[model samples]
Target: MDVDPLLTQARQLWIELAGAPVAFPTRGVAVVASAESSTCPPGWVGIVALGDAAICTVPTDDLVGVVTRACHMLPVAALTDPERLAAVLPVTQVLGPATLAYCDDHSYRPQRRQPIEQLPVHHPDLVDFLASVPAEDAAECGLTDITSAAYVLRAGTAIVAAAGYRHWPRRVAHLSVLTAPSRRGRGLARAVAGAATADSLADGLVPQWRARPAASRRVARALGFRELGAQLSVRVGGSDQTRLGPGSNTTAP
Candidate 1:
């Protein structure tokens, strides 16, 4: 695979979404933040790391200083670890410590053995497919929310698997893939995801795979997506935007 462009593209994509790079006490870990951080998935803090470079977005500006301090003090491993993030903030909920991956023209292994149908992401067939999935699985996969056209594998009128991408900042195709619980273990996720990813690349979009579940990650790996780093979203306090981020709070992971 082409390493230089991949590295540069991945690094710049996160910078655009989160913020510009800033100095950190740690050598390997660089930090960045921007106004966009406020909208970052309703978490106390959202950190998108590539290799040793971590781009963090907190809900508020005041938290930047405290989060930065924690970045300097925490090891790279700790910074990327969702539970370990409690060392700095209140740490109410953790969304991920997910593996971040990207695909290159050379690396992507398109799965063409299975037939796939492309449709508007919100099409009824795709909607019903998502509806058939277990609630928890549907929520976790986030496929129903994709803005790109869907690539689907159907079982009669029902969709057994689906894949698409959310249009994220920096033209990133944040890939979403879901296989119905009853239809899994059939290589269905990869077959459809491969089509969606191929289409995204053809349109000159960068494909991103933020895989949380081991099964999802496995499918991404099988399609030749290269894992680069991790993403961890931390939220503290109750429903209120409390002081955990900016003020003093030291809870261990």
Candidate 2:
């Protein structure tokens, strides 16, 4: 009867693990990354509430511990552990003995993006366009069924920019394949973003862009994606860094 509690728990754990808002966090929050993104009946789901935090479970005692003790924290903190972070997949954790020092901060908030009227679909010259890109990039974009999802702008494709989503449900869509470095200063980001936002709106979902660079957020602004705040990824046995959770956004949802 009351699914709100389960939904809240799953969403919170998803935010903790994935570092972004999740639209439909599954009933098994402890294993959310591995769980199928399906909504479950409230009665079938178990809940574990601790202080201000709660996690959805599969009606098992061990699952309760994993959800309450292990899986509930800000993403930035959880990401520091290699084994734990690996479970989240696609998100890299900086290991020790690395050259780069990890840091956390929001560089800036992007300006609001203007809407786009028409996006020209690329024609049969498309083979050359597809050839320019790697297959992994295409797979990432096509994860959400947006057809013709390949081609980065810097490769000198006509579209100027390309973008696509990873379905974490409506509350969260990972925006990937933003643009190539050589394609900067064009309105490609706006065009691609406008199209993606329109798709999300059509699906009755809220779009949350993930892990965008500070410069990329400028493009996001033109495409109607305000910052959900900056997220941090720290390396193990690395130098000290301050971390914030969901507070560094220039624009709040």
Candidate 3:
């Protein structure tokens, strides 16, 4: 199957984030050890798949053995070398099969946006709003100075929904959006997400939305994101023991 050009670009951006050598094949799984600090979630590995190939980024080559085992859980049809993945690592610890989605300039379409307020992280109202939401939600939107930009929709003094992006390699924007529990099903999520995405595109960055919620995926589609592929993460213990399951408890992006 032919890989989407945008998906290919997204994979390359991830490889760059890993600080892997440019000579690394963009289409296969490899064990790369980089001293660089990862921008990805803590203890979570990243896998970018397109057509029949995948690029898996682990924090260190020491984890490569376990990463290969986790890759076995991926759908065979999606991997370029399932046999190799199975052969390399022991089937001991596997953590997840998370879905990752991406959107580029061509793939995104602006939706009818709501009246959103772009705010600095230090804005009093934004700060108060973050406090009102779950801590995980606040952190995901970069409450700690990680996002380059943020936008929120409010009902008077109360923030109903918010979205933002963090700087990722190759000018890619890692997008995150959240809607208050009581305010969901009102299109507020899409409204704020659309606003943030528009800003990212305006700044010449490709917005990437990675999450597992079907509702989140719907919001992404409404804003013109395409499902690129799924990622699998495995936890490697100190002694090479592996554990396999879903991702840890965290708010959806």
- Return the top candidate by TM-score: 1
Candidate 1: segments with Cα more than 4 A from true spot: 1-3, 19-27, 31-35, 236-253
> Residue 228 of candidate 3: its Cα lDDT?
72
Misplaced by over 4 Å in model 3 are: 1-3, 22-28, 35-46, 58-96, 141-143, 239-253
- Candidate 2 clashing pairs, residues 3+ apart or interchain: 113-221, 113-222
lDDT, candidate 2, 1-253, per-residue tens: 5544323433444445432223333322233321221222111222222223323322223433443443454342342244664463332233121111011112222324544333223444333434444554433333224332432333333534565544443254444444433565666665555555556545644455543244555555545444322222322222232332221111100
Q: At residue 15, what lDDT does model 3 achieve? A: 66
> RMSD to native for every prediction?
5.9, 11.9, 5.0
Please write out the lDDT profile of model 3 over residues 125-192, one tens digit for every residue: 77777788777676554434436556888898787777777776788777777787778888988888
lDDT of 1 by residue, 2-114 (tens): 44666567777766655444432223555444544422454357776676566677655677787778777776757778656787767777666777789978889977677
- Per-candidate clash tally: 1, 2, 7
Which RMSD does model 1 reach against the true structure?
5.9
Best by lDDT: 1
lDDT of each: 0.70, 0.36, 0.63
